[model samples]
Target: MTKKNWNINLKEMVKVGVHFGHETKKWNPKMAPYIFKERQNSHIINLTYTARFLSEACDFVFDGAKRGKQFMIVGTKHQTADAAKLAALAARCHYVNKKWLAGMLTNWFTTEARLEKLKNLMKKKNTGGFDQFTKKEAAILRRELNKLQEDLGGIRYMKKLPDIVIILDQKGEYTAIRECRTLGIPTICLVDTDCDPDLVDIPIPANDDGRGPIRLILKKLILAIRTGRAL
Candidate 1:
């Protein structure tokens, strides 16, 4: 990582609205320790913790990247989808920007079968094999490919389970969190006040809704991953 990247601080993060959290009424009791206090009926996350935890999470990711770890980027919420997609693309990792499949990680066998179908179809389409088929048959394969691309295009090359999972909104993407937990994969989550930090392996308390903060974090993370590769 660069010397400048190590200096991630609360001042810049606050300018990006990273300190904002859920309303007081929506806050989880378990997150009280990380809460700074309440203002205007909204719970403010501890920016001090945000700076510290986010840096730590970035370092963890860098270390893993150096070890050739594969990550599954997850941010299904409207606020975070773009950040997730950009991070995954920059890091050359798989991502789920749309809805996550129910049994994607848990039911690996069934999911792999579906992925195999996508691969075969892609191969046929690429190799001119599909030209031998009738227009109706070719159209069917094209439709299937388009549908799968919307859902699994980012991860089509993932032959095995990911080594790590990085997510923007922990509370919103609870299903992904649960599946990662089930498989005992290390997870990093941007947890808001309404979320239970305990649920994630590395919890960085910050606002998950705003695109600015998410983009900042994602950019830094991607930088760290790239640094790992160069190392």
Candidate 2:
């Protein structure tokens, strides 16, 4: 099949997935029976639309990367939805770690230093120096360390604004959008029906609320990057 036809088929599959959840009575009654059938239907439509939008956005990312454009992947709260962020990294686009700590984006050198510290700690753990704590303490420390690293990494590429900003959640990343606007960069966003599309240059109307949609979108983008279409 032609690439266009393949894309159309993928888009239709997303629509079907969304339609599956339509009608409160249609939902797996085990989940939340109180919600109206219409609400459930709305949920399905949002998710399906999001999946299709993400798939297309991935194609755009691939094309842009091939042309040597800089893209930024931004998301709020959900690291699992960060498939596009990973793709941008693979494509050599500057990636802002989604868990970036406050002020890290505005202060790159400090963030890099913190990342270095985390790296050193990881190295120490790898080597024989650090004493082994109880599982609880070890787990807690590891978690804290991981958080620190995520925060530091998130803003590592902030010195230069991206040419295009791909935002997974419009409401979640208001600050990121503000920053993008300040830099006059174009934005491509996965916008839920509840969101206003005016904020984004390229708005892919879809459900920005669920993990399934996020996962599907990220997977497609990662695939594109891996295939070298994203360069």
Candidate 3:
């Protein structure tokens, strides 16, 4: 895939409000290099840097995908959850948008066990295995299935830890990032001015709270992953 074609211009980024950052008072000092200026008590991210980092991240994803590496997209925040799920689905990648269960990565054995249980429950439901149970028992089992579906639906089939993780909000998904870090998995994050870039492998400084910008970034990343898969 050609990197040039996937590059988004600064004008388009500005239109989507990607340049907007957290309030100046809340800004992280480590992010000074990515901050263009302070406007109206909020930091304005440097779109030029955003484009550069994003391109680098896309290239990395493309190469990894070509090598059959797996990825997991995470965004538990309300504004970013839907977009993350859609993007991951588009690229046929694993995702966790509803909630980031602690030890989802660090405790691989337990997590995999839970995923197995989820698969079994789903299979039983689809095969009408619940018909053998009484009404109350069936209802109780159905409730368990629903809960597992909500919590582990996206990752029900993920057999192993992902090679890389794309996080929409650095602050909101700190626990997930930490798990990745502990497990030696690389991370690509959409970090706002208030977030520390050191926490991620590739930090694409942007407005993590804006749905438009999140969707736009995720769209490009998905395209890169899809292209790699095609190879």
Candidate 4:
């Protein structure tokens, strides 16, 4: 995109409360009444810097996905924020379940090992090995093993480093960030007001703590990716 085009889009995004930064807070009260107005709408309005960061991060993910690069969408919890779901829909990306494999990013080797065990157990059960185990033991083992297998299957979808790691909850995803850093991969995250922005390569400051902002931001990013791809 041309510089002028980018600048125009950025301006428009800012007008819509996309990237309101700390500097904007310095504006005279009369000129910045919208800040307070936005605050009343959501708790994140007070976190202008974070909102700006998230807007840029959203752009980054959209751009990268349009180029056909692989992106991984990970979140703190499953079926909660809708960030992962939006990202997957936009980029056709892989969604990593946030439970059982806590350190899937930082400790991939260990995660892989656990996944192998789960796969083996699944295979054994599939072949009618349930008769060999006591009923209670079989039930417990099956439940735990199935959860692990689901996570493993998600991880297996992206065998190598992704072009970008989009994390919904920074605190909940500490291990994912550590692993991304270790592998020299870039990250895009919705950083809460209290979070350290330096942890992510592309930090979008917002109320990473809430569901509304997360859903809104993620939906925009997915739309951007889909639109860009159509072009």
Candidate 5:
């Protein structure tokens, strides 16, 4: 891949185990079309379509970046948490690495209040207001800060709803997808054979639980976003 152009071939994709899908029994009926065939009782995804869909999704993300659209990345799974944070940070977008707070985007006003409280707690701690208070008061502030950080640390700067959402595990994070659909936010997701591809605007059929593939795909998205920054 060149600096100005980024593309991965079949060999690289195969080396990353992108073609592997869920077992035939666990496969979703809607994903039948994307399945090339059943091999060893498991569905083999059509890498041809995976590449095509990935390219299209990259175009969408890149264009969104050029237009200065905000995107939120959701990846709370063990396999994808680090990749999600890295990708979102690289793209300068919000991420949900821990918990996808309910109504985070759809009902942001109420959510903002919670975020504000978290901010106030941090301010009190930084200002040493707890110094004059009792130990109980100091302990309360500490507990609140830790809880809020675990809940909303990755999304502290999400001042408003995102224009698009990029997710790692569609099936595992279906609630995130559902909220996006309800709010009319377009989504791009990695859909395993068990997931419904129709849930996302762009679905890349790949192993959503693998580190290598998730890393590669997220890298591609980061590259696309960075490239758009130049425009």
Candidate 6:
């Protein structure tokens, strides 16, 4: 394995509140190893450990991408959704920012069917295929197409289950994590102090709720992925 230098900056992470974790009362005991100290009733994530773990995760993602492994970025929460989509787009990876359908990965056949439907609807609408229908019918079709696009747009091009999944919120995306686990897919997740670190294959302990932290972390990961793909 080659040595890779990471772009994760410890001082920058602290400035963006990435060191901040959930309140002490809400913290999971499993997160003790990553907690630096308690300040103002909240846990402070140990930046040293955060940086180390994040670098390892980035390295893994980069190497995987270099080998043409597919990734799915999952973050449906309001704070992280947009960031997730943008990062995935930048990295050319699949994403699920709007919602996580229960059988998204475990039920590949159904998900593929929905994706095929979405593709057909989009193609028809783009090439004037909708002109054959009456105005009212076209309107109905357009609405359904829009709904499908909003729900499955990110993964429409994904022909199979992803080799890896990057989850933004461990607690909010518990179902997604479980689905990945059930399918034996590896997961790299941003876990707050209140989240179970053991649930993910690679847990990056940080503030999962803040937009700054979320964007910062995703940005780094995307850069690594892009670098890998470019190579």
For each candidate in the order shown, give its overall lDDT on alpha carbons: 0.87, 0.56, 0.92, 0.62, 0.87, 0.92
TM-score of each: 0.94, 0.59, 0.97, 0.65, 0.94, 0.97
Q: Number of clashes in every candidate structure?
A: 0, 5, 0, 5, 0, 0
On residues 22-138, what C-alpha lDDT tens digit does candidate 6 reach at each position? 889999999999999999999999999889888988899999989999999999999999999999989999999998888888888998998889999999999999999999999
lDDT of prediction 2:
0.56
Candidate 4 residue-wise lDDT, 84-163, digit = tens:
75568556776675553556766767866776777778788889887799999899889987777666655555665577
Q: How many backbone clashes does candidate 2 have?
A: 5
Among the numbered candidates, top lDDT falls to 6
Query: Tens digits of per-residue lDDT for model 1 on 136-199?
Result: 9989889998888887887888999999899898878898899999999999999888898999
By TM-score, the better pick of 5 and 6 is: 6
Ordered by lDDT, highest first, the candidates read: 6, 3, 1, 5, 4, 2
| C-alpha lDDT (0 to 100) for residue 220 of candidate 5 | 87
Off by over 4 Å in 5: 1-5
Q: Compared to the true structure, candidate 5 yields what TM-score?
A: 0.94
- Per-residue lDDT of 116 in model 4: 72
Candidate 1: regions farther than 4 A off: 1-5
The Cα error of candidate 3 at residue 190, in Å, is: 0.6
Can you write out model 3's per-residue Cα lDDT over 90-159, one digit (the tens) per residue?
8999999999999999999998888888888888889999999999999999999899889999998798
Ranking the candidates on TM-score from highest down gives: 6, 3, 5, 1, 4, 2
Give the backbone clash total of model 5: 0
Judging by TM-score, tell me the better candidate of 1 and 6: 6
